[model samples]
Target: MENTSTTLTMTRRFDVTAEKVFDAWLNPEMMKKWFFTMEPTNKVTKNDPRVGGSWEIVDHREGKDYRAIGEYIEVDPPSKLVFTFKMPQFSDMEDRISVEIKPVENGCEMTFTQIIVIPHEEGWTEGDIEKAHNEYSSQTEQGWYYMFLGLKQLVETGKVKYPS
Candidate 1:
């Protein structure tokens, strides 16, 4: 069976320096404030911000822990980052995410992209693949939208006013 993939890209402008925006993605303390859609009761972030390094974030919400693990494919400070992302509880499939930041007139503009690969099984139709792609794309986009809002608030105001 052949595998299918979908790519989704989102861009947001931040009223902060490029370095600040980029650091928010790799800094453990910054991530704890703006990474998730809902604030986790407890969170642990371990990051090695270099090419070939690994990173993990485990958020404890309610009584369960959700883990996000990945390896750094590329890490260029204040400009670009590329990493693999996976949640063991969700699926075995791993996705690729890339973040690019550029200086604008006032602050910076960030473009984020996620590539999701779907494994195809026997007897799966085109419609089935399309449905899976659409569902994942929509959910991921929405999740990032909220996370970006939180990141913006934290970087611009020194506090996360909008948790979600």
Candidate 2:
């Protein structure tokens, strides 16, 4: 459709090793620990971490069934990764996501970027677009940040703890 458009892109950096950091996303059990916080909240909806991986999280505030079902565009093991994220309910969004890892003395620097494409405005109002975009970016940033932190805590300490 002519109206299909990509509105925003967000990037966040994490302080951790690329290997450890990537594992948090690639590993199913590990991802559940920090990926999506429960509903105000209920149970974990869905969580899978593979090339055709899928995930869904439900809370009183938001209900999202994340579908990252695409062949790995690129996988460089601890160095770089690329995948697709599609959420149909949110105006036909097909997000092209990528992560880059750079090794550092302390650990690794992780940079994540997500490009979200929307088909229609759907129920959004006048200024709602800004709010939606900002909220999405912030929420994703927090999720990734927590993932990195969890990954770091796990590798550095050999234990993983979920947020309460």
Candidate 3:
């Protein structure tokens, strides 16, 4: 069987330097504050932020641990980062994500793109693949929306403000 893939892109402007926004994605200390979970205290982040290096983040929620593991494909400070993302507990599918940061007059803007790929089963039709892509993209977008909120707060104020 082959595989189907879809791309989702999101952009956010920050009132901070490009380097600061870019660093938030790689620095384990900074990542724990805004990367995955609202409860930073319960999150563990370990990163080797370089090309070919690997990173892992585990968020402990409700007595369950959610793990995201990935390998860095490209790391360009103050500019771009590309990585492969996978959650072993959820599925064997691996996704590629690229984050590009550009300096603007006020601060900076980040463009994040994720390519989600899933295996195509024998009985799956075009509609089936499209539906799966839509669902996956929606969930991923929602998750990143919250994460970007936390990232903005942390980078701009040196702290995160959890949503109420």
Candidate 4:
């Protein structure tokens, strides 16, 4: 397998305690409200939050199911989380996501990183590879930004209002 990759990092501050913010990530109910907004709704089929535990989110839309699966690599309550993320359609690749929540006055700062490993296709030029990598990073950044906005709204108002 050819090796081509990109890392997307985002930082956000939420007006909530570190524990609260961190809980929102691992809690299945809370994740259902903010994670993966591309679809209309989702079901958290499995949410075992611990080292080696697995989680699966199934997006339900148009009478179809789109699922994403992951395994927890590390879990430090109220502080840090690391996981291996994968989508079945891209079975050849697995990505690693890390989240660090630091306590700050009036709230917390969350640093999120996702390292995506893109398959290097044969016969692709350097320019083609760069373009594809940039596009993937941009889309991932936008998607997570919106999800974080949803998370912020939910944490502040106790309701889900994803940004448009």
Candidate 5:
């Protein structure tokens, strides 16, 4: 059995143009600079910014290599992007991420949301599943929070530092 979780929404305003912000998300070079805050160093990044295109990033940290893969579902340059995201470590679990960028007087407002699904594993009770789901949700939320911070810093200051 598989269960879908509630949508997690995050909003942030960046002091950059909508195109700039959107490009940063799709551009491989820009993303390499600030994709994963915890593992800022990526071994490789392959991004093809177009509908039906795929992207992947491999990160090395603490002597372990983690990889995330995603595909573009919808791409509206400078305005919106929808994608499917998954990390291989999570067995049979995938999520959808939607990003909406709106031009503001100062810069741009980005509304981000991810719809997550947790897969059921054999021998796990209801309580155990819920507990695992909650823990994963919390950690995911925190990771994105910091990743956004890195994105903002990169857009604003033109540089970012990720702990090594």
Candidate 6:
């Protein structure tokens, strides 16, 4: 049995231009401004926005290495990014996680989703898909909620807060 959960979609609407919003995600310097939760706290020490480039991040936690590794399969500046996500201690059931950005009326609409199953070591089984979804729904939603909030604040007001 395998358990799986999907983030379905996390869309954010901003008042800034699509180009600026896009750069917020593609530009390494600009990205570091609001990409993570906030503090510069989690530094994406190594970021390669180009296709096939690898990325790495280190969370200044007690013992957490919040890293993102793997090759970028697709990269369309200010539009789409598809990459495989991995770490030394934990691995996603599905190797890929992708984010698509589209220009909205006055800004950008980002649709983020992940094709993955729960970590096998968590005692997840095939019939636990719904359970997995239910358990992860809140945390996952909150994550994106804060993420968009952080991005919105930074882009609109030049403010950033990490781990909020």
Q: In terms of lDDT, which candidate is strongest? A: 3
On TM-score, who's better, 3 or 4? 3
Q: Note the Cα lDDT for every prediction shown.
A: 0.86, 0.58, 0.89, 0.85, 0.84, 0.65
31-133, model 2: which lDDT tens digit per residue? 5555443223434545444456555544333454443333456777877778766644454456777878788787777666777553336776646666665
Tens digit per residue, CA lDDT, model 5, 1-164: 65747578899999999998898898888888777523355888889989999998888877887888889999998899999898888555779999999999999999999987776667889798888778778877898988898899888887777664
Residues 1-164 of candidate 1 have per-residue lDDT tens digits of 66788999999999999999999998888888777523455367888989999888888876889888899999988999999999989778899999999999999999999998877787988899888889978988998988888899989998877434
TM-score of 1: 0.92
Model 1: runs farther than 4 Å from truth?
Answer: 37-40, 162-164
What is the Cα-based TM-score of model 6? 0.77
TM-score per candidate: 0.92, 0.60, 0.94, 0.92, 0.89, 0.77
- The better candidate by lDDT, 5 or 6, is 5
- Lowest-scoring 10 consecutive residues by lDDT in candidate 4? 37-46
Candidate 6, residues 9-125, lDDT tens digits: the string is 666778777667666766666555555434545666567778888766555556565665567788887778887765555555445667777787877777777654554335545
Order the candidates by lDDT, highest first: 3, 1, 4, 5, 6, 2
lDDT-best of 1 and 3:
3
| Superposed Cα deviation of residue 50, candidate 6 (Å) | 1.7
- Whole-model lDDT, candidate 5? 0.84
Q: Give the Å shift of residue 51 in candidate 2.
A: 6.7
* Candidate 2 weakest ten by summed lDDT: 1-10
- Worst window of 10 by summed lDDT in candidate 1: 34-43
Better of 4 and 6 by lDDT: 4
